[model samples]
Target: MSRPRDLYDDYTPSQQMTDAIKAWEDIVEQEKEVRRAAREAIAAELRDARVERDGVEHRVSQEAVARYVPWSEATVLGIAREYKVPGVRQAKKKAADAG
Candidate 1:
């Protein structure tokens, strides 16, 4: 069986060869630009996806902790005390409550 002739073998004249080469170069340049743009767009989309995933993971972790941990005001106060930070105080009842 005979192998198929390459496209480069089809061009005969020097001018035709030069034109073909120029056309091929133009095509290659355009393709490179297109590929670069596509890669940049994909990278941006991936970054956005990562940020969204991080936000979702943070919310899920908070929800999981809230579900699993029995946190109370006293517990918060105790933590604050351990950290040597001021904690929340209870509001005093108004005199109207004595009526």
Candidate 2:
């Protein structure tokens, strides 16, 4: 095994290094495009998600959506707001009642 080299040393970028960086940049751009599409699809579904309560259909709560998506509730709300998802709102927490 080779010993670690000093990372702070001033060095010229080699052709291999430059090519690899360009390749990684292209890959990252493609990943961003795919992620954008996925977010839009997920947001659309989340916006339309519904549940039956008292024999009437209602939009699922953002908290529930967050749990189902396995993302933070705030993150889910952020995406909803970004995508203009309808019927989703930030929930207000109520303090416990004092006896």
lDDT of each: 0.49, 0.78
Candidate 2, overall lDDT? Answer: 0.78
| Candidate 1, residue 48: how far the Cα is off, in Å | 0.9
Query: Which stretches of model 2 miss by more than 4 angstroms?
Result: 1-12, 88-99
**Steric collisions counted per model:** 0, 0
Q: List, residue by residue over 1-99, the lDDT tens digit for candidate 2.
A: 999978867878999999999999999999999878867866877878777766967777667777776568888778888998875454444576433
lDDT string, candidate 1, 11-57, tens digits = 56789889999999999999999866654443333233222342442
Range of the 10 consecutive residues with the lowest summed lDDT in candidate 2: 90-99
lDDT of candidate 1 vs native?
A: 0.49
RMSD of 2: 8.3
Top model number, TM-score: 2
lDDT of model 1 at position 64: 27
Cα RMSD to the true fold for all candidates: 20.0, 8.3
